[model samples]
Target: MEKIKISKDEVTHVAHLARLEFGEAETEKFTAQLNGILRYMDKLNEVDTNGVEPVTHAIARKNAFREDAVNASLPPEASLANAPESRGGCFLVPKVIE
Candidate 1:
């Protein structure tokens, strides 16, 4: 059996931080589960990863965005044509800040 890596108090503190309420039994269960996970992590640390390259993602990812290209946009005169009020080729609105 693995030694205790997480205590009941630590589990309760984490629950408080996450705004979660747990009874005594739930806290005990979580403490045991967390300790098991930490012990498994300790086992994983013993593996040799010296030759492995660090990766940002588990699998390869391709750029999902469309190719950037120059495109014509609506002219300023056309844009301000529908404004409630316009001043010097720009839309005018009420002052938002003092």
Candidate 2:
């Protein structure tokens, strides 16, 4: 498997783009970690998966839910009773805009 090498400058550039400031120690540490992850991905690329079939779900099942139906809603008076203020059967809240 080919090895991956991440440089300090690349790490610093990425940090700057992300609006983060990293010291020298953090930059070196992140470089080593990112390179290690890339090496692992390269190793995974060697696997032979030509005959594998694509799957959308782990368990072969369709929608497992009840059919939708119309339901009764609470009366407006009961719903507005909980509000601190109401006008003409409508809940009133503080105006958000002038």
- Residue 39 accuracy (lDDT) in model 2: 74
Q: Give the per-residue lDDT of model 2 (tens digit) for 1-98.
A: 54656678988888889999888888889999998887777876788889999798788788788769878899999999999999999989899899
| Candidate 1 lDDT | 0.88
Q: For model 2, where is the 10-residue window of minimal lDDT?
A: 1-10
Q: Can you tell me which runs of candidate 2 are displaced by over 4 Å?
A: 47-98
Could you estimate the TM-score for every candidate?
0.49, 0.42
Residue-wise lDDT of candidate 1 within 1-98, one digit each (tens)? Answer: 65888789888888999999899898888888888888888977888999899898888779878769978999999999999999999889999999
**Full-model lDDT for every candidate:** 0.88, 0.85
Clashes of 1: 0
